[model samples]
Target: MPKYILFGDYCENALEKRTPYRQDHLEGLKQQKETGILVTIGPTKDNTKVFGIYDAENAEQVTELIENDPYWKNGIWTDYEIKEWIQAF
Candidate 1:
């Protein structure tokens, strides 16, 4: 498997807008965690952006995972970028 980093921007007023889909988003993340795909993820302290690290076979796998997340489907996440990572730790 390869490691990837995800950077996502939230929609305007995401804190308020995300309320309805929060549960589903969390549930999807939980399943991804259990399946060993999502290594770690969270929004920045100010909630300006979302950051995540993923372990997957390829970028497409990670893209599909993110695309299926409720936040993305519901427009809480406006856009995102994925990059193959080289972890030096």
Candidate 2:
């Protein structure tokens, strides 16, 4: 499995609207982890962005996961970047 990192940029009002969608978002990540695709996920200290590590065959798989997220579809996330990660540890 290849490891990749995803960076999600929040919309201007994302924080204000997060409460309603938060549970769904968390549930989605939990499902991904249970399915053995997600490695780890969380927001930055300021909550302006979120970063996730995923285990997938390639960048396309990780992109599909991001595209399927509630946050992405519901407009909470405005943009994203994905890159293959090489863990030294």
Candidate 3:
């Protein structure tokens, strides 16, 4: 599997706007984590951005995962960019 990085910008007042969908969003993340696709994900401390690491077959898989997130559907995430990453430990 390949690894991908996700960089996303939050909508204006994302903290407040995200409340309605937060539970769904977290649940989805949990499910992804259990399936071993999501390595890690979280918002910036200031809540302006979101970052995620994913292990997937391809960029398309990661893209679909992000696009289907409740935050993305409801606009808590305004936009995002995905890039294949090389992880060197």
Candidate 4:
């Protein structure tokens, strides 16, 4: 498996809009966590961005995981990116 980083920028008013889908979003993360694909996930201190590290076979697989998230489907995440990560010792 390869490691990848995921980043998402919330839309304007995303905080208020995210309430309904928050639980679903969390459930999705839980599924990934159970599979051991999600490494770590959280919001930035400022709450403007969300980021996570995931272990998957490839970038496309990670992208699918992100695309299926409720936050992404419901437009809470206005924009996002997935980058293959290379951890340095």
**Runs in model 4 with CA error above 4 Å?**
none
Which lDDT tens digits does candidate 1 get at residues 10-81?
Answer: 998999999999999999999999999999999998888999999999999999999999899999999999
The digit string of per-residue lDDT tens for model 4 on 1-89 reads 78999988987777799999999999989999999999999888777899999999998998898888888898888788999999996
Higher-scoring candidate on lDDT, 1 or 2: 1
Candidate 2 lDDT over residue span 35-76, tens digit each? 999999888888789899999999999988888888888888
- TM-score, structure 4 vs. true: 0.93
| Candidate 3 per-residue C-alpha lDDT over 1-89 given as tens digits, one digit per residue, 9 for 90 to 100 | 88999999999999899999999999999999999999999989999999999999999999999999999999999999999999998
Backbone clash numbers for all candidates listed = 0, 0, 0, 0
Model 3, runs deviating above 4 Å:
none
Off by over 4 Å in 2: none
* Alpha-carbon shift of residue 85 in model 2 (angstroms): 0.7
Candidate 4 minimal-lDDT segment of 10 residues: 6-15
Residue 36 deviation, candidate 3, in Å?
0.4
The alpha-carbon deviation from the true structure for residue 27 of candidate 1, after best TM-score superposition, in angstroms, is 0.5
TM-score, model 1 to reference: 0.97
Q: For model 2, what is the C-alpha lDDT against the true structure?
A: 0.88
Clash list (residue pairs), candidate 4: none
Q: What are the C-alpha RMSDs, in order, of all predicted structures?
A: 0.6, 1.1, 0.5, 1.0
The prediction achieving the highest TM-score against the true structure is: 3
Candidate 1 residue pairs in backbone clash: none
